[model samples]
Target chain A: MDSRKKEGQMKTNDILEKKSTRRSFMKKLSIAAAAGSAGLVTGGCVGGSGSTEEMGLKWEEYFKKNYRMMTDKEKDETVARLEKLAKLQDDANIQMSNQEPREKVLFGYAFNISRCKGYMDCVEACVQENNLDRNSKTQYIRIFEMDSGQQDPTSGDGKYHHEVPVENKYYMGIQCFHCENAPCIKACPTKATWREPDGIVVVDYDWCIGCRYCMAACPFWGRRFNWGEPEVPKEELNPKQHYLGNRKRMKGVMEKCTFCVQRTRQGKLPACAEACPTGSRVFGNLLDPDSEIRYVLKHKKVFRFKEELGTDPKFWYFMD
Target chain B: MKKIFLRSGLFCLCFVPGAVFLAGLPAMASGGGVMERIHHAEEPYDSMAIETAYQQPVKTVRAKESWQGGTFRVLTRKDSITRFRCSVCHTDKKVLVKDGALFTHDDIVMNHGKGENGLVCIQCHDEDNRDFLSDSSGKKIDFDHSYQLCGQCHFRQKRDWLGGAHGKRDAYWAGERVVRNCTSCHSPHSPAFKTKMPETYSLPLDQ
Candidate 1:
């Protein structure tokens, strides 16, 4: 009781100490009015550059809160606006998703180095599934052709044009490993890139400032930057898209693999894993002890690409 | 608190209508024919989210042995084979001649175990039953349970496959754990992948 009375007294005293006079309040109001009017004049001038609908949408998009901070209604509105804009620009019917991560699911991937014969079917499937820009040659998966005795992946040639599974040559596939302690997230000046609750790292293209800090910070060169406007052939564009995964990205923003969020969130394998003919790529929830990934981790002689860096990449590699 | 509430009520009364009016003005001014607002009906979030994708009419068989205290299911092999029901032809009780001529299965290369002490067809196939495969002990095995025959020699791979470490699973990661059988990928005649050019290679540095 005594402490409550003292708290009340302190609050009253604090209010009394910082009380504003009518004159000062009026002065502050006048200053605010002046600033608001100046802003209105400049805003009107900028609004003249576009159609009325475009201006309205641009203003709403500019003022919309960050994806994490947005309410469900706000996310809906953002999706509506983006979809409408896509229709206006390309005359393409695209569905942009705002799927929340599922519960009790942390995705993990396993690749068999012995089984992967550098087929590159996965790279082709990734291109079609993600609607990646064709002119830019944006490939998410790279199959490195390494000598059988080599320990490092980067020492191999990824550009071999001849027949695959050459004598004394083995294949190692690499993509965004979606590290647990993601350095790219830390390097983003804006919190544009973040790891999802399901352990898939994603980037908000709209929020990225194109600073390329995340790219520079990534150890594996996992991130890709758009130098100019990204172009996908109209007929080749994937109609199904996730706002964070394969949605149409503009110039300057960065994109990386989200483990095919559009499909994976709906309980399907990533396109690369599905397209692999040799049954090499295995994907499943890491939390499930009975999952294929867990089985591989337990029974096989598995190793991560870079275990010493402490990135704790979800991707693992094993030989038969 | 009363004053604050009254003030907020007054502010809402003054501003909400104005905001609503501004929001609706664009639709009216542009007329109805300009842009059709695409309605995205909100769907209830599904926890498993696998029902739509689990489309296969899978015929699963329980594994004879559990992998890790948990029994799993494997897709059956007989349904998808092109020329199944081998009893349609080999019905007669006759000892099959060692093949030097091509007759029914000319397409099959019979290249498996081609090195030392090469395997013959009758080693795996039961001449008496015609439809069933047999282990070295001549135990009759159904076509669906061909893994038992394969496991006699390749036991390590069979164990890995049973444990979900070595085979392709169904499209879903969260539903009934259905995996493909060994014969689904590997031909019983030959099981090695031949050398071939990669489908696509866009090496940025090389270009």
Candidate 2:
């Protein structure tokens, strides 16, 4: 009821925002006209009828409220819009959802450095499972092959092109740590990035501006800026998507791993964890005492990559 | 008006089921002769062995299933164990395989553990039981129950497995916990993992 009242007030504010959005919309339309697409608007003739390309980029797209503060109705509208946009652009039937996290389940992940063979299967699994931007090769997972007796992960080469499980050396993978005290959340000016109840930090993609503040703030180089419209082959596209997670990302937005929110929320393992052939990646609910992640933290000598920064990363690393 | 419709629908629905139930009430209360016969056939035997509920492995992937492609899978112990049953060759006098008995497996190179020289096939595979494996305690365990035999030696790994630290748990995380046996990854004959290129998606250029 409170949100509905707030939304009503926002609807009044939307008219104020629309006047400004109209100026930008005019500029974009003029640019479209110069590019020989003048027929799109002029041919419509009638009001709000059959304005092909112009109708898709209406004033509502610009005036939509920030996701976190939006009402449930607004969220549903946003999800529907995103699904329609995906179908129009990619010809892919994507399910963009606003799925809530499982109750009492705070996710934690741990990987054994010793066990990782630099197989990079996790990276592949993450790409396919998440439906990440293929054209930009935007991989959220990066496995670092650290030299033997070297503790520094930054020095480790992620670009190594050799047969792995190198003798005397070990491999360590890094992704969005989903920190409890996340810096990316602080850097997102629009309140687009926020940690879910399950400790998986997610981005409201529609709300995010082109500003790369979150990418700049992230210590582990976790975030990826989409340079152009992310190109995923229609055949290879993963239909299962979450609006705040792995839905088809638009251009000029910063994206990172959400620990496979669509899968994890439904009592399934993260793609990377499921694909680890070495049994190195362990994932479970941190709130559940009997969970594997808790066992790893309690029993194993686990440490986060950037422990000094005090990000309090939910993800951990250990050597067995 | 809504209440009237709901009430009429409920009344109709209740009568439909109630009428059918009333018609069958006498027959059900009297009981079927077939059920009585089935109850009588269920004999109680105090001397009968109390067999445990069989734990069927519902997982698709197993240790043996992921082993090899064409010839290697056929030649592996999983197939040979069933084909050339140990009891077929090893009778009254024979305890283990002699020279030519294992000559078919000339390509076999045992390099699993450091104590491979002292180890014989019968130590892990039960000499008496043809179909089952045995732990150090001489417990007759089914082939599916390889974890019991494996847990005897690799206690730390076993502990981790039980704690959900080591080994792969299949499909989903929340439901029934179904994990892989030791053989799902490690080869019984030669346990070392072969080094190779990663899957195509994670190549340097792709990154």
Candidate 2: which stretches are off by over 4 Å?
A1-62, B1-109, B115-118, B200-207
Q: Which residue pairs in model 2 clash with each other?
A: B63-B184
State the lDDT of candidate 1 residue by residue for A36-94, as single tens digits: 76686577778765455665676577656557657899998998898887886678899
Candidate 2 accuracy as lDDT: 0.69
Model 2 chain A, poorest ten-residue lDDT window?
A: A1-10
Candidate 2's TM-score reads: 0.72
lDDT of 1 at A16: 45
* Candidate lDDT (C-alpha), each: 0.78, 0.69
- Residue-by-residue lDDT tens digits, candidate 2, A1-320: 23323433543453345567657876897686567545645556555564465365443565576665568998898778777766665567888778766655567888898889998999999999988887777798888788888877676877777887788778878888888667888787767787765568888777788798988898887888899998888888889888777887788987889889888776677899889888899987665555567668767888887777756678889866
| Stretches of model 1 off by over 4 angstroms after superposition | A1-55, B1-53, B57-67, B93-103, B202-207
Docking quality band of candidate 2, CAPRI definitions:
incorrect
Interface RMSD of each: 15.3, 18.7
